[model samples]
Target: MQRIIVIAASAGSLDPLKQIVSALPVPCSASVFIVLHVGPNQAVLPALLGVLTDLAVVHAEDDTPIEQGHVYVAPPGWHMRLETGRIRLDQGPKVNHVRPAADPLFISAAETYRERVVGIVLSGYGDDGTDGLLAIHESGGLALVQDLDEAKVPGMPYAALYGDHPDAFLTAEKIGERVAALCG
Candidate 1:
């Protein structure tokens, strides 16, 4: 089965994400899903990420096909969930005070994909993605997190690293390289 990568981040995440995305090989075997905390009115993340990487990045829409080699970013103020090979955007209650929280996306993918999911936590101000990472780990999926020293804001990565379940601990660039190798 192809990989399903769900990444969650918040404050001070853009640069790390750019490196990670730019390093991922073109024609990857994973369909990447990203959640970033942005206000309801801000919608430029996908385009910004698009300019930094070779992958085709788009704001996820309801019922959209989750195709390999493409990057789908949750729209501001909505959560994106994986439903088999498709995506469903939900206006569900926010987690950790953020609508597009990583927990929902990570848990959805972990539940549906089981061992095929890769849950990643990056730079952020809080512990939003930690529970999601736990779900992936409990389901036998790989949980990867950035090293705290490498993160602009270390709270999210630190939370994941504070636990024993994360499969690997590395820098953002290294994580991207490792992901490319896994999905190649």
Candidate 2:
């Protein structure tokens, strides 16, 4: 079965995101989705991350077929969700007070993919991705987080620990390594 990896990040996350993306294997085994808090016009993340990895990195478009070895990023101002073997982009109400919040993507992936999902919460502010990581954990999916000591902003990771323990607390690079190994 193909695996789905959902990642959430906010403030002080760019370097970690770069490290994680750079560490993945060229032909990654799972389909990766990322939701980074950005404004409606700040849609250049795909290009930024694309330069770090061999995998195709593109903005999530509604109804795009899920493809392994690719990384789909939530477009600015859109919530990205997974449905079976496809991706859905929604411009619905803001979650966590952010349009392209991680909760919706993480929750939908947990609900749709169940045990085949891997939810990762990286360096960020506030608790946007916490509940979603809990959903993934309750659904029997692997829930992981960046080590608090390593996070530039520890709020998100700390909140995740408070709600439910993650499978591991690792550096961004280690997280990528584990993700590759699991998907492999």
Candidate 3:
């Protein structure tokens, strides 16, 4: 089955995000999605992240068909969700006071892909991604968190660890390696 990876990050996440994306092999078989809390008008992230990875990286757009080897970054001000084989963007009420909060993306991926989903929570403030990671876990999807020691900001990872242990707690690089292995 084709795998789907949904990642969430906030403060101090750029480096890890870069590492994770850079680690994926060229022509990866899984579709990747990301949500990073930033200003509504902030739109340069996709290009920044695209520089380090061979995968096609683009700002997610509504109705874009899901494609393997592509990295879809949630555009600022819109919540990105996976629906069947396409992308869905919405301006729905923000969760955790963030438009592109990780919770909605993770939950949506979990609901849509079930065991085929992998939810990853990286360095970030607040507990925005915890419940969604739990949803992924409960849905038989893999849930991973950056190790507290390695996380630049521990709130998000800590919440996932304390609320319900994820499948793995790893460094950002290791997380990327594991994701690649899973999709391999």
Candidate 4:
């Protein structure tokens, strides 16, 4: 089974992102990590996201063990990295103009998990997830991007599809189905 991570929307994203996450199948075998661009000063995101999904949703904690069936959100203003089955929280420099950028998370997962990883790029602005998705593809892991027409802001998905050919280009609903399949 593969570990699946989702790098979703930032501005104008709360509703769609929540809908997608909430639609994930229960008792999933993949550990779902999310990088949703947000301001550094915002309050608790895990609590907010938890309200939308039945899965255990929480902010990434330093050295926390990554487990299946849990959803981890990168804390505001920090980059989240995966290391030997554990989460490594870093105050790393922002990439693509966003702290906790999707690039680092996707890159780290590709490096650590290799072919046992699945990367998904959802709706958002800028090319944050493009480089990381490329890394995932290079590592022989599956890469998915939300279809441009289905994205609220298609820049991120468009950049990903053009920058690196993903394995799947799908809508949020289809993304959920594919993720569940990958986890099976």
Candidate 2: lDDT of 31? 91
Give model 4 RMSD, 1 decimal.
1.6
Candidate lDDT values, in order: 0.88, 0.91, 0.91, 0.82
Please estimate how well model 4 matches the true structure, expressed as its whole-model Cα lDDT.
Answer: 0.82
Error of 1 at 164 (Å): 4.8
What 10-residue stretch in candidate 3 is worst by lDDT?
175-184
Better of 1 and 3 by lDDT: 3
Summarize candidate 1's per-residue lDDT along 1-184 as a digit string, tens digits: 8999889978888887888888888788889999998868889888888987678999999998889999999999899888988899989898988999999999899999999999899999888889889999999999999888888899999888775469988898888898888778
**Selected candidate, larger TM-score, 2 vs 4:** 2
RMSD of each: 1.1, 0.9, 0.9, 1.6
Question: Each model's TM-score?
Answer: 0.96, 0.97, 0.97, 0.92
Q: Which one wins by TM-score: 1 or 3?
A: 3
Clashes of each: 0, 0, 0, 0
Tens digits of per-residue lDDT, candidate 4, 45-161, equal 788778876789988899988888899998889888888789998887778999889898899899999888788888788998899999999998989888888788888888998
- Put down candidate 2 lDDT per residue, 24-124, tens digits, no spaces: 78677799999998888898899999998888999989998999999999999899989989999989999888989999999999999999999999998
For model 1, where is the 10-residue window of minimal lDDT?
Answer: 156-165
TM-score-sorted candidate list, best first: 3, 2, 1, 4
**Deviation in angstroms for 28 in model 1?**
1.3
Q: In candidate 3, what are the lDDT values of residues 149-169, reduced to their tens digit? A: 999899999999987779999
Better of 3 and 4 by TM-score: 3
In terms of lDDT, the best-performing candidate is 3
